[model samples]
Target chain A: MTAENQSFQPKLSDSPLVVGNHRLSSRLIVGTGRYDTMEQMRASLEQSGSDCVTVAVRRERLYDRNGQNILDFIDLDRYTLLPNTAGCYNAKDAIRAAKLGREILRTLGNPGADWVKLEVLGDSRTLLPDPTETVVACEELVAEGFGVLCYTSDCPVTAQRLKAVGAASVMPAGSPIGSGQGLLNPNNLRIILEYLKEDDPEYPVIVDAGVGTASDVSAAFELGADGVLLNTAIAHARDPIRMSRAMQYAAMAGRDAFLAGRIPRRLYGAASSPSEGVISSRPYGTLGKGDQGNSQSGEG
Target chain B: MVEITVNGQAVNLPRPMTLEEVLKRVDVPPNYLAVEVNAEVIPREEHSSHSIGNGDELEVVTLVGGG
Candidate 1:
């Protein structure tokens, strides 16, 4: 739908999404990767209206002539920079990455620099998280005073373990990383949500990774997800800028729909119009003279 | 000469130097870089005192695009 024709204003919950004591109004988090240029990344981020963006810690471009850095393009004042350990494969490496991110943030004087998006992949093929290593890293990072956002599979047990280990937010992947499969096992996600909410109703459960399009994001929010972290869905879209806007609106729509309860389904079709209106002149069981005697007659 | 790896690239320095001096030699802005010596993070406050020796492995990381 065109922007001019769209009139639905989502009635989002007044309650803010809280993660590690930081309250956020926007539920959609975008990433800075996979875009063709930094300009596209910036535009998409602006269009998405995301309050948070993830960045990886890599080697500095010490010898580049252009002297352009990703940080230079991003507005630190507008977005909360969530540094991630995307390349790290083990707990030790992930911990070091997190520490390095904190150091960089400390130098920049960002208040939320201590927060890290901890991801430790098990292998290179699937790019799935290693649950054992993830738990170990979460414990250490929490002890080191870092607000850890743990990424894991859509397993309720693993999510509970991460939360128990002091992860500020439990991010369960909808599917494999960068696969764009989009909520492959929604029933498992539902169970995770139910289990977490049973323990604490306000616990933040963000669906991270494997969101292909706007509908995937909306579905996650409809499943009672607190937030969504996506990169390829917007960055790799045919038109990243437009896709970003679509994702933003979809997130709002999904959250509002979840809040507004839906109706139950039945075997028989139910009429929405008033049944008391009597437009026919014939009696309940009596047929008019013009009507055929057969029940299959075409008379109304 | 002291040989060390910086971001997985081997580099030879004339002599042992502090992390701060190494950063200046490499032309990296200290405020935007995080230094890790031998896989351990060296806080900004310790850059002046932290020394790089022979065969030391240093990883200087800056923020980059990621999901």
Candidate 2:
């Protein structure tokens, strides 16, 4: 029987997204950046319904009149903090950033913050991930006992290599960071997904960048990606709160549609109604109630 | 007087002190800050005993906003 005719429930939807040792119900991971205000960030996060949020580590304010820290605005119980090595340009710097992130999280009484989103950019022009450095850093971070979520290009070989090198999750970008290109090469992404899932169906593959709108996020889910990591798409939207809500529903709908199994395409049309059940009709020359003129005359 | 760098900024103190005392003098909240002395991470429990000498480089990092 076709999937549409089946009545089985989609177990994948009920299963939580497992990254490293942590299980999250919401697959959408949002970033705490580019928002106009901390309130907006908090509200958008709530609207997105994401359980994990990524934060960067930097020097603390020695003295501040505003008396504001990102941690103060975020509710620790609601979101799992995932620190990222965003500004690091090489493996050494990325490792240092990850270590600093771990220390910061530990100081905050969150010892489970060992999960680091390792991003080592090649250069400032393209902002593409340096695959070689990323692998090196991933291996070292994994050996150091950090749950390494290595961000890489949408190349199947690189994704496979990162996974083989002890990366808990493989995150490939749809395009350059913050470019809003929206899955520039979907076929490549599909290949990566297929290659990774070939060995382990439950291997976590997250699309980490180049998401432009709600549909972009939905498309990622429909392509069988495990999750999406986005910042500019929502944070830079004209109405961030509404966009966040849209993304939440879009991700869920896409996952459901993928699990339900889409119908195959065909070259010819197939009638939905019974072709033999039509009432008896006269020749084409005969006119009906609404057909004042010969319908066949249009063929002339 | 002894000088050491905190977050890349040179700071002078009358004498060498522990990581805990430097953090206090710099107004960094002990609970929200992490101390790395000379590129080595000092655990939270050892911050009190990790002594800071002259010309020591310390990197004090805290959680910030990111994507």
Candidate 3:
């Protein structure tokens, strides 16, 4: 549709979405990592206005010195838990973690837990997604009846491949994971969103990483992203709560602007002057003296 | 031989020793402050494994109760 001619309609509903029976009210998903304390994390989560938060699942049960379980603080009823395979390096390891996540959720009585933030990295330095292994893991997880959320490269082709492999949602990283670079390739993200929409209008595309500021989140939404997956942006912020609120507003503003159909950027500036006018150059102070440019208060 | 100082104790080890080797040799508690190697924070899961070479300055910064 042409930018000006197309009708503006909010495609997303105000209601919640049932992902494998877990209803999420907000599209934004926050992470519970890197926070200095539980109070800070809670405040940030509240400010981001997320309906869900992610947690990493390890093989063994762990407890702090106070014998407090890490999972104890998360109020599952208020927010849906998205267990991620953050440390997994390959398809097998990610899938293993996914299974463990499912089991934990099931034990907690969340049987229809199918959503996972799949991360299979090639190295620790860049934390770049290995497309080959990521696709493999996604295909397997989808086959296992899980709604796979593939955290993948920003490359449009890579995103398309993930969608083809039965990914419920394609989460393309804005930059390197956790670098907080903030929209390194906005043009590429825009292209990815356009490509995905053209292929399957119903497919959800979320901007998942390297978002450092509220403006970065807004840029993602302006490109017509379905939602955002944020962690470091809030966790590492100097004032996480304030940053969270800004992020929330940024997401909403960006979504609204996208729905408003932003005007295309023009290469050349266009003049909007009268076709025929006697353009005259007057001295700066004398221009307002005559009838042509007289002010309402003309005593002087 | 490489000179490595961990938790204020100087020790001798071969060059190119992995962090796992150093942790195994040191008497610092596993629950000590987060490990910082040359000012870069390394997650605990990586401490058991991940290699490092000589001239690498590693510091374990733990979180303490302080308002």
Q: How displaced is residue A285 in candidate 2, in Å?
A: 12
Expressed as tens digits, the lDDT of each residue in A141-251 for candidate 2 is: 999999998889999899999999999999999988899999999999999999989979999999999999989998999999999999988999999999999999988
> For model 1, how does the per-residue alpha-carbon lDDT over A1-300 read when each residue is reduced to its tens digit?
988669778654557778995777799988898888888999999999788899888874643345667888888888888899998899999999999998998998876697999999998988899999999999999999999998899999999999999999999999998899999999999998998889699989999999999999999998999999999989899999999999999998888878886667655444444334548665587744444432332324
Model 2's DockQ score: 0.72
Task: Please tell me which predicted candidate would have the highest DockQ against the true structure.
Answer: 1
Best by lDDT: 1
Estimate the TM-score of every prediction.
0.89, 0.89, 0.69
Model-by-model DockQ, in order: 0.75, 0.72, 0.03
Model 3 chain B scores worst on lDDT over the 10 consecutive residues at B58-67
lDDT of 3 by residue, A1-300 (tens): 888667677566444433444556676888888777777777788888888888776522244455444455666677677767787799987886676566556545443356787888888899988899999999999998888888988999999899889888889999987898988888888888888889577568888989989998988888878888898888888998899889989988887787788866755433344323537654564533223422234223
Q: Quote the chain B TM-score of every prediction.
A: 0.92, 0.90, 0.63
lDDT of each: 0.88, 0.85, 0.72
Candidate ranking under DockQ, highest first, comes to 1, 2, 3
Per-candidate TM-score, chain A: 0.87, 0.87, 0.82
Q: Clash pairs of candidate 1?
A: none
Provide the global lDDT of candidate 1 against the true structure. Answer: 0.88
Clashes of 3: 3
